[model samples]
Target chain A: MHAQDSSTGSLIAHTESPWRLFWQLLQRDRLAMAGLGILLALAVVALLGKATTEWLVIFDPTTVRLVDKFRAPLSEASALLPDADRPLTGVYLLGTDELGRDVFARMLQGSFVSMSIGFVAVGISIAVGVVLGGIAGYYGEVRIGPVTVDTLIMRFTDAMLCIPIFFLILVVVALLPASIYNIMIVIGLTRWMGISRFVRAEFLSLREQDFVLAARALGLPAYRIIFWHMMPNAMAPVLVTATIGVATAILTESALSFLGFGVQPPFATWGNILADGKNFIFDAPWLFFIPGFAIFVIVLAFNLLGEGMREALNPKLQRR
Target chain B: MSTAALLEVRDLAKHFALRRGLLGRPSGWIKAVDGVSFHVREGETLALVGESGCGKTTTGRAVLRLIEPSSGSVTFDGQELLKLNAGDLQRMRRDIQIVFQDPYSSLNPRMTVGNIVGEALRVHGIARGAELNERVAHILERVGLSPDFRHRYAHEFSGGQRQRVGIARALAMAPRFIVCDEAVSALDVSIQAQVINLLKDLQDEYRLAYLFITHDLNVVRHIAQRVAVMYLGRIVETAGTDELFDNPRHPYTRALLAANPLPDPSSPRPRALRGDVPSPLTPPPGCAFHPRCAEALAHCDRQTPTWIQIARRHGVACHLHQNTSRQGDDEIPDG
Candidate 1:
């Protein structure tokens, strides 16, 4: 009996860590695994692109060479290349654009830009969402002066939601100088309402949970109770929202750049690359197709990963 | 028991206001805990026994000010708790801690057991670093858990072990009073015995006063020095545990005691109390339990019963006991 009990105990200990359990659950989903694999590859590509462009200077995406223009995929760059440029130049793997820029080099840089924008925008949104939502849910019906914090914050969120977000982004980006930072900040600020609403809903229920009550009973200060105790428990939905939000932010940046408002020229972005290639759709299908396919795969991968996380985190759907 | 009470709650009430419509206008109040008055002396256990929705948990929370009381007073060691400022109240919480009902949800799942137990010590600025770890291990040992168990998370432990972790958390505060709010209600019957004994032993060691809130009559008889029986939102009777068990006063108290199942199959089951507990949102007039009280008087439907002392440390709130009162009647005022 003791031996059996010990074995069961060990089994339980093995699966006890929540993150391990979540990973185990996530590994069971094939689509999520595929998405994860794709994301990992993209991340490596983005990192290498960043290193080469910023520090290594191995790939220059902006060098104009009219001779290399409209080179088909898998074809070598002009054979008349000088020895100095020989080491740096390569075959147009995904073909060249109208500006004679190597599409491959531009794409590598674009990957980094897109990935950073996705992460930074979502980071800003998550920060704003968690704080506002926590305050709204924890201090529900608490009046600061004229109105309850819940009502005031929720009403403002609702007002923000009513605005067509893309158009709002368009208008804001139009007024401001087209800097990458401004686009990230604008998208982050505009897109936080959904995340805040999710966090508020989670907190509304979690605030009534016994652990929260126990925390309060222990005399934890309000901030400690909210951030330290409650926030960790309320983070599952927030994480799923964030995972999907990254996809949306990437899409938004891409759309903005496609419309000539994204990260300006000299800085390669998937959206601007696609925009630059739209004019040559018939002559050089690789330019438009490559960037478009990359965007499609990335957004789809994020969505899949987010869905997997949601299913894994849900207690009711747990297999064990 | 000592004459000086360590924790005293007087006319404590917690009325949740029901709001409706978009504008959120106050519709009415659900008086979950209305006019509850009780006290626990040093090293004594005052078990607040009641049915599920009788406001026993509410009363316990109000005493600790976990759920802020809508009205009334909670005094701990001569200090008015309800009147203390946020900072002072937080400081005062060092002497008052609580053990929640559901062991599963009581401990923070994301925190390791050591962090959970040592949190109070850190929060109160009582200990830090090595001292905090030592204290947490000691407290866990005191609660009958292996000191090494502190390294694990709450989910890794069984229900009984998790409960010990919860106790260790409360014990870490070195609290004078701890509200065990149905602390053992969710554990198995065998585990319940072990936890109750641990609580008793801890009380002896620390001179801790407990407002043990539960509906388990058998458990109450085993641990509580005093028992307060509640029906709906009010305490119907309060007496010495043995006295209340041997000779229960008030129809609600009698019904509750009679409802406890016996060990022998041959023993006939007492008639169960009829109807559900009246909704606290719209409680029946006069006695809250009148609709279900078998021996309810005609006046019980029209006039609220006054709490009267029938014997020393024994009080009953029923019109039947009103005439036999030895002291002046203490009418429980509505909140």
Candidate 2:
């Protein structure tokens, strides 16, 4: 009755689909807007940084300059000494790293790695999680032979969760050849438990609702019922989880790379850049500060975005 | 009523298994619908009336196989419904549909009104494209909704409008029989009349048969051609609407009639039945109604009553009705 009265009073139900309503709600929240703006800007920068590596930076990120090493930003390194080798690169924007690689260029290039790892890893996690979690959740109590599907999947998920995620990633990465794909897979494989549990909880309740019974009465096949009717209804929580999971995945990739087991050196991941900066923290703090700050901003943006999405998509929150 | 029954149910029972304790073993069963038998003739409305847990809703569902009946047979148009395979049953669903109890939860929230109504047509491959849209719009109008409302979601509609939409969805299937499961219970009194009139009009026009399930006896007096009163999952009495209203035979049926509120305060009023209904989990041993029956005897508590035909179209299950055959009475007219 309330939804009906309010629906006619406003154009919320008439003009907009739930998704569009969610967007409108998100747009109204300044924090969500800021989060969205940060992510968009970050995405643009990462893409532009990756695409224009040759034209924009001109200096190859991996190319080392021995004399330019440890140069403070915007300095003509040892120019007054007259015996110093002429700097090969232009003025270092954020200064050169410990290896004399252009910190700005490397950071820009590292964004590509960080962004891709975040997206691809999250995508992988979502794909695996949605399917596995969907099955686990939708068929939670259903049994196959001796094992209940929910019990089997959840038990396995619990076992996976028991292993500290980072340690699990380390063990897997240690076994497999360290590569971008490997890190993505390991992160994806280790991160689906929460999503599975969320989807299962949603399914447990949703499957009992009258609409689901109505769907069945309409004689819709089980697959269509689960995917079309139930999945969309269950997706609000999953979307929130995925949004937050993206940040977690990115952090994991960063940690893995910083520990020398992630995307190999010379690829210039933000993690390895931070790793490269760790040793030179006192001597050249810019190396540590630049990449460290980027990670902080990106992670914070995703978290805020996740929080906003949760509120916007939530009917209870958005109804007012 | 037509001689050809569109739907016939015989001893259809549904007992939901209840699990208890940690291991979740089957502890007991909820006898929601037990030995319910009835028929909905072509173009006839059979109202199955009962209290909340008496299983009128369950009977409606079992007839459609929405919830599979535990035991018994349902024959629709001479076809054994329970014996049909999945594909056959699905195809059979076209002939029989249900308008659910809650208008809010009946329609899928995510779907447009058009999709909700047109889905039956689309799924059955009965109509498509502009024809689908036209049929949906026409049915919408038939239910007193604007054709333009098809683009809107169910949440956009009032309870009355939503119930209309629910009716329209069932109507779209062009079904011969529909189980109106408390279809108008959630609406306002004024809206209830409008929906009832619409249902009446639709029935007259399309010759649609409806099994109107409800707890409202007053509504049954207006809509039902025949009434079946249920108590603890059993049909205690069934008769032509006028006969059941004027000369109710079963004690449970009398109790239900007594419970109906009379607007005229000056008339003598019968006291309502006392005590909450015994739980369906463990109904009283003999006749389920004996515990609450005012006319109960020692034999009523010891022996289950047989369903006896008291009149041409009236059936009553009670110990009082059983003695008449012994008296060699041709016409009791007991009331």
Candidate 3:
């Protein structure tokens, strides 16, 4: 009896919780770890930018000096501003743009804008996707005249997909006033189709599960069945989609700003700064290269994180 | 047993329409449950037995209105379930519960056993807080699980334990009738007996009625008071457990019984029915079992046989039993 009790104790001890297993799986992938590290560092940078700009006035992003214009990265600020009444201190870390504003300060401010747009846009898309997808999948069989709820919603999604989204965003953003909120809303509204499809597919399969049927048989309301019972099961794919979606939203915002359709001037977004550096690309490559590299690294980080999450969440791919 | 019927299903049918082309045009109807009729008295077990895709599961689902019946009457305690509005039907579900076949799929993997069992109580506003936890603990203990096990998720348990969680979920509502749809079919042979005995004990303790649907004949013989053998989409024979096993009237019922595996190795294997079950999409015109029935008559292919009562609580829908009926009326027999 004592031996049997010990054996049972060992057996119980061996069963790891699902969350711990997911974390363990994620940790094994070196590329995913690199991605997570990059994203965490960028998040800290974005938060620091917000704090410095709003509360502590650390780096002045908008201050301009005509003498310091077109200074290469790591150039001496004192050398550029010699014999000045207000002599600049330290080195120009990432150099100055054509407008003579500090590149490092602008990049820091841009980090905050890019990160906020990425999150808020993805949040909007996830909300729209889950709602539309939940309705489509759960009530897919319910027919209205010739078309089903599934058919109607999916066809609308297909129609949205058919349009070249960038051009559509270009036209809409051109018509609307240039603001960060407008950019976030437009990118969010257009990019939700893929997430919706993921959610719809998840719901379609999940609704037929016996647990869902059991929930129904237990006299739970339709809302409870959809949100409480089915949504949690459908969330893994949605999380992956939303992670990738943040990257897409960030890229789109950058592209829109580059084309002069995104967040307007006075706000130093990466895209606008890149747009400013376009004419002087050869003379001051760091101005364009710095923001360009930032965008690339952040997007790649999010994509890697999303892929890692996908593999970790999938039970078939999990290692014992 | 009580003479009053707790649940009565009359001429229940569920036809699934096969869609074709991009527009989803109706190509054909698969009559999954065609004119199935049965009842369960208070605390009685009525086993609906059939092979896979024979509509026994569908019948049970339709009776509870889980999957809506195409056309039929399901009267649960004299309340027409089909006619009830959404809210009323939902309210009515508290009394009628179901235990599913696959233990792995029947439970929410994310939920703790306590939440899975206590969700119904919270949803119906029956209990909350400490009372809810106490109830969940009590129900868990009743299903032969430790009260401490309620904190664990469904993935931590074995197949038998998961099934017990399912039963506890159903039993939490204090339901009068439960449709056990292949409840033990997914468990091991050794575990099957334990679940069956647990179900039996629960029925006696709660006076719960069960519409037990399964293809396993041994389980039916062990737990059921009455057995209904289905062929194609319709019930061919239904009788008392002992009467059906001792004297099966229909050719389909006999073939099904003969096909049961024997423990004795030296015993010659009984000749099983020839050919597969006909597809419900396009079943044979007359009796659906004509192609598979060994004693098929020429008229069996051209005309359908009417249901006839051979004795008290014994009925068969076959041409061979057409002439041996004590009650000559073509109407379905009611208890």
Candidate 4:
């Protein structure tokens, strides 16, 4: 068994045309590499970002220590730490907001929300879309509701596409109860139509592929043939789409929050922070600048990664 | 012919409703396999040879019940193929295996060769664990592959190797009647010969019957014990391999022989046929080949010729071959 495992590994090493080869080529791309490094670093920051809020001065964000209203950023910066009113130290580096709340702590905490929302929402959307779209394309007449729901689902997609996305989101948000979970659901559910369409087309082409037919002829179950045998080859486009989809979801979440239906008050969302800091743009530019810059950097990283994946997945680039 | 007919296809006709018109009324029909009939006795290679659009493939598919025939009976070991339900049909499919053309595309690139062959075994609950792996390795060896090749995927192997894997997959079930549906048509000439020779050896060793479908007359002559020549969805002639080549009664069969390019350049120039076949959708009213026939009489266009016994173990369907019954006196093989 040990010898067999070694031989198999070596055989794969010899013949494996795995995505790692393509990703290695992508790692050579300086801009993409930098972008990926920044993205990964940001992810780590998001995961660890909550720890910063826990350690520092985290008074309730809406708590009114009414005396310190409209205090300037640098001037009140020293006052808000666990160590009260000490001479300038490492504590409260970015300083206090008008509410005597540590803005830097809130900002750090806020990142967890942003990245989590972006990651989970996008992950959910991709999961739903890839499966739904794959089935739609791979097995065209597979049921979405009753009696070959393919035509109905497809038509619904067209109708949804025709409706302006912002307005559609507004209607959905209006009818639905307010919550971050609901926000994620709305974005994920709506976005899946594109993936389904893309996946469906991929499946249609792939189902006719010889390997898939070979799998069928081998008497493998339809589900196994569809998911296991066909999905890997058909999913290249969906992968690229999913990468870009993360950025889109993040941007959309930010927009919804800024428009006031998204992450509600008391939650330290970058969108809400950006919304709150909009009036004080000139007075305390750091508030808007920080969230704005974070969104920009993260979105750009995703775009870079997505573009890199597109190149990597391209069959034309597969051969030397 | 052997006593036990492993696969018997009688009066099989697969008609495709080509185009629906006028409130879903049948506008036309494509007689893909029209009244086609043949039988494969135990451990015998029965070749179905014809040109493109001749429905030889259709006959093979119809017999397998891959495409449901409009009207026919396919009896494999005395069981009606058409009467079987989905589960039974699926179960039956394991016994009647097929090796498709274009070996390059016949394998799933994602799967290793072991899985490709072992899939059938796994599906049918034949072997598992160390035993399964051992069986797969043994099967690979049986098809002239190294045991190490099992770990490798299809894309890693060449066309010939992939075909060997295909054969291994088919033989994994230990089937009785294997359908080679233009199995070697896509291979190089040398490779074709290798596969052909391998198939013959495998058949001999396993005592497996085969329905070898091909357009290549030379290959039919080489491997087939008996050959059925199809034309426009009908078997125009069938005879013992030597008898068909030596005395081809049907004109269509003669034209097919003439059209085949001779391997030897020094041989007499091969006689080429005139014009392409008519579409199956609007086939000629009576005898489908009458328009293309060189010796077509007025009556040939009006009436279809009956498929009759011309000689011992020989049959022909042609207006010209009516005198065949009287001309050649021999004991005709009773159906």
Candidate 5:
């Protein structure tokens, strides 16, 4: 009866209605919102770096100069550099790394690496896991195909789940030549199994519903039937899982780099810089403090955001 | 409409393993669908009515091979549907569709109405762009909705509208046979009427065949041309709608009729049927209904009654209905 209003007005669900609900939950979690804000700011810095700096300059983060090495932050001794390599001491306020690289520039470049990997990997994990789960849950009646697939998928997930992911990731990274792309793909591909199981459980419950039967009756094909229709209907719990997964992925990548397995040496990931500053902790505390705080805020932010989304998206919570 | 049988399920059976031995062999089977059979002629509505655990849903799913049966053959038109490959089976799906029970969780919230309906068209390569738009609009209209609904999400719609959208999505595929598996059971009474009426109108326009499975005899009575009453994975009685209701042959069917409390208090109501439905896994050795059948005799306890064809196109599974006089001396306490 409510959608009857579409007769008079627009076809889309009033965009404001759902967003308002999202806003209400998100706003209440001040910490999550703050984390969300910080990550967003970091993203903006990464995206707009070209506009912010005159030279699109060494977006190739790997280029290095050993001679201008380990220049301390804003110190007079390490201040000067010639034209081609010139970054003003005032301009490069965070100072340079061991390669005479501006730490701020490297940080901005590295933000792109860390966040994109975190997001893309999680996205892949969620997509693959959700599809597998949906099929296993929905087609419980079909004995032959799903039985083997479900077993393969679940056992694979079990293998991944039992192994310490950090240790496994290190071993995997070691086997391959260290690259940001490699880390992103490896993390994303391996992490989807748990989400798949969770999604399957949701689908198992949801497939018993009448509308789904109605959709089936209408002869919706398998792809649209499952992915477009059934999956979205059964997606809430998965969304919560995915949100938490993003934070977990970020933390994993950071930990890997810190242990000298991820992002590699001189690449200056948040983990690399934090590890770099550990030696200088007694001398200059700001280096460890800033990046350490960034990691803490982001992890906390994603966790809070995940919580808010869970409460917001969960139909059980909607009733209250 | 052309004269043809829309769908036919011959001796369909699906036995689910209840428990497996250490060697992975099934120790016992829950005979979920046991040699059940029925048909829907073109443009006719056939209802399969049974209490919960009666395999009505299973029968419906098995007919379309949604749940492949342990044994049996199903032919839609002249073609054998069970033999079709996955791709052909997918194409066959555009012909025989199903409507499920709960409206709330069926439609994908992320998909807009247009995509939901248009997907079937895309998969079958029926329409695209402007033609797809027009076809989608046409379908929305056929289901008593405006074309404007094309862009909306399921969450925006009410239970009834979502159900309509569910209907609209089905109709978009232009299917010949549909299994409405308790489609209206979850709706409010008013909404149920709307959906039922909509289904009727769409049936008339499309010349569709329906295998409507429901526990609600009232709905079956209103819509079914023929009705089959199922019990414990077996259909015990089947006849034309009026004949089955007026002269229900099986004790289970009689109990089902007795259990349905009519709204009018003035009408005589029979005594309530007692005892739970017997488990499908470990059913009574003789008659599956004998554990609770008041008319069960010593003979009833020793042998399972075969489906006897009585009246024209009518069948029943009870020894009591074998002759002019009832077999058992005991009478049901109707007071």
Candidate 6:
């Protein structure tokens, strides 16, 4: 907030951008800061895993040692390697699965798959939603060359909204290849309706704002007014929505993988890791807890960040 | 200042369609600006004075094509504004601009003061880079704001400062005519005076013509050389400012003049007009002001009074001043 100088009776320039102010406000929110810390750590680990997966990982997550299958954890791995001739190279930090693979290395690798799908799917969805929604909102009923546009786009959006998004994703995955890329594309396509509706609502309200009229009165082209003048102001809510949408996309991917319709084996996502742990839920509960806990933390971090951002950007809610 | 009018509007009318019920069929129309005709000569201010919902602001917007007129001709320097193609009309917008009423909403919050003013320049391709910044700073200074304030966003400025920025933005286009649509109505009285004075100074400097739309009669008396009083959607009376103030011919004009607050404590407060302004949605069959007009005759309820010339450059649309043959139905009688 800017304050007037009493001494000189002049306006002191406090030209801090809203994002900068939002950051300053967010710094005070301890829970959100904790979320931010967790998110940053996860992102760093994911990036490192992506870069050094072949070189740095001690164990190949797929390598199955039937003799060492279902090893308990660190204690069992060391006990199995007791003598001087014992093989210590295949030690599993987080124990072996039914197929005798390292859970710890798999978890690290799973972060890469889960987080990438989350971000890329969200990015694709935001792009599609913002463009389509902006068009529908700005020009309620417009003609492009010959065909009327707004009705077609909005009716399509409405039709898309009528279907359950998860069901739609399931159908898409069933039709196409069930690879990570296909899952991401399907999630991106299905999940964009929420963001599109949000962007459209923002644009509809912003379209009538005096600044938009002022831009028109200044003889700016319609595109300039819509994209440059109105869209920037409308981005605050879109940004908040996108942040939360990332969490949803991640959760959706995990659920799909758990259903065996997402990323297949050889690739380790949190969902597949959870799927692997389902058989051992009672005996070796660590498999279920590890991946489930990771999903919960990632989603919680994004949600907290999104809520803090909403409060920070909103002028009425900015007060301590 | 030249005698040639910079902007002229003839038979300007804007009717908004009201869509009632679920099917959204047009039920009726709100005649916001019906058959309004006026012109402002260079370096002169023509104030459109009316109460709320009297269509003064609508008239201003209609002239600029911000709200497209239902029917009429808007000629700026003999150019047929409505007839021009989109590109040509946009280009012509450089010469004809408007300053809106609300300061807060008028300026884009995302843009700094410099960009707000420079947008007009840049859009018109008048300047860019160092020249654009220099022009913006210069205009800011001219509007009584510091050049350093250019970096500040719209929210940082007070209402007065924002209004100044609005003025600077309009001036940046170097427009010959500007429609100040209640530009000073939202400001403090002291700030209003300063802005009015600034407008007068700018007019003198640029030889600018202004179509000032406002409900403030006193501000009009100070700033406007001529006045047009609107009732519902029609101009009830128009004359030179002093003449309209002293010998207001129409009942509505008299009521408006009487409503002006007197500063002198010795003077008694004049009686306000009875009844509310009739809705433009369903304007009274004949005279829109008859329901509220103190001097409304029985004939006023039956016939819409045509413009009757009362004196040199003075006209009133009322039966009380029926002293001449009606100005012909099709012809616009004023310059």
- Top candidate, metric TM-score: 3
lDDT of model number 6:
0.82
Enumerate the candidates' DockQ scores in order: 0.46, 0.37, 0.44, 0.26, 0.34, 0.41
TM-score of chain A of each: 0.94, 0.89, 0.91, 0.85, 0.82, 0.88
Candidate 3 per-residue lDDT over residues B1-335, each given as its tens digit: 98878999888999998875467877899999999888899999999998999998889888878898999898999899999999999889999999999999999987888889999999899999999999999998788787777777788788888899999999999999999999999988878888888899999999999999999899999999999888878988889999999999899889988888878888878988899988899999999999988899989998999888888889888899877777644555433
Task: Give the candidate order by descending DockQ.
Answer: 1, 3, 6, 2, 5, 4
- Candidate numbers sorted by TM-score from highest down: 3, 1, 6, 2, 4, 5
Native contacts present in candidate 4, fraction: 0.21
* Chain A TM-score (model 5): 0.82
Instruction: Write model 6 residue lDDT over A189-303, tens digit each, in one string.
Output: 8777777787888888887677787777788998888878888888888888888888998899889888988899989999999987988998888888889999999999999
lDDT of 3 by residue, A1-320 (tens): 10111112322424455677788999988888899999999999998987775567667688777878887887877445534312235667789878677888888888999989999999999999899999999999888987889999999999999999999999999899989999899999998898889899999899889999999898898888988889988898889889888998998898888888889988988888888888788998998899999999999999999999999998898643
What's the CA error at residue B175 for candidate 1, in Å?
1.1
TM-score of predicted structure 5: 0.83
- Candidate 5 residue spans exceeding 4 A from truth: A1-30, A47-92, A95-106, A116-147, A172-190, A199-221, A224-226, A230-243, B1-5, B19-24, B325-335
Model 4, B1-335: lDDT tens digits are: 47778988878999988554534456788888888778899899999998888898778767776567999888999999899987787778777888878776678766778888898788778898898999999878777777788877776766677788888888888888888989989877777777888888888988899999999988998899999989899888889999999898888999988878888888888777778888988889878889889888789998988777876688888888776474442222213
Give each model's clash number.
0, 0, 0, 2, 14, 0
- Per-model TM-score versus the true fold: 0.94, 0.92, 0.95, 0.87, 0.83, 0.93
Q: Give the candidates in order of lDDT, highest first.
A: 3, 1, 6, 2, 4, 5
Native-referenced DockQ of model 3: 0.44
State the lDDT of candidate 5 residue by residue for A126-148, as single tens digits. Answer: 87887677666766445454354
Kindly list the per-residue Cα lDDT of model 5 for residues B1-335, writing each as its tens digit. 45466677777899998665544467889899988767678998888898888898889888877677899888998778889887787778888887767666667656678877787787668888899999999888777777887876667777777777777777777888888889899888777877888888889988888999999988888888888888888778888888888988788888889888788999887777879888888888888889899888788878887666766667787777767433322211000
Best candidate according to lDDT:
3
In model 6, which runs have C-alpha deviations exceeding 4 angstroms?
A: A1-14, A54-59, A76-91, A143-149, A318-320, B20-24, B324-330, B333-335
In the predicted model 4, the residue pairs found to clash are A133-A196, A137-A200
Candidate 1 lDDT, tens digit per residue, B1-335? Answer: 57788887888899998875455667888999988888788999988999898899888888888788999888899999999999899889889999988998888888889889898779778899999889888887778776677777788777887888888888888898999999999988878888888899898999899999998999998999888888878888988888898888789888887889878888888879898887899899987878888888889988998888888778888888878778744742111
True contacts kept of each: 0.49, 0.30, 0.46, 0.21, 0.35, 0.43
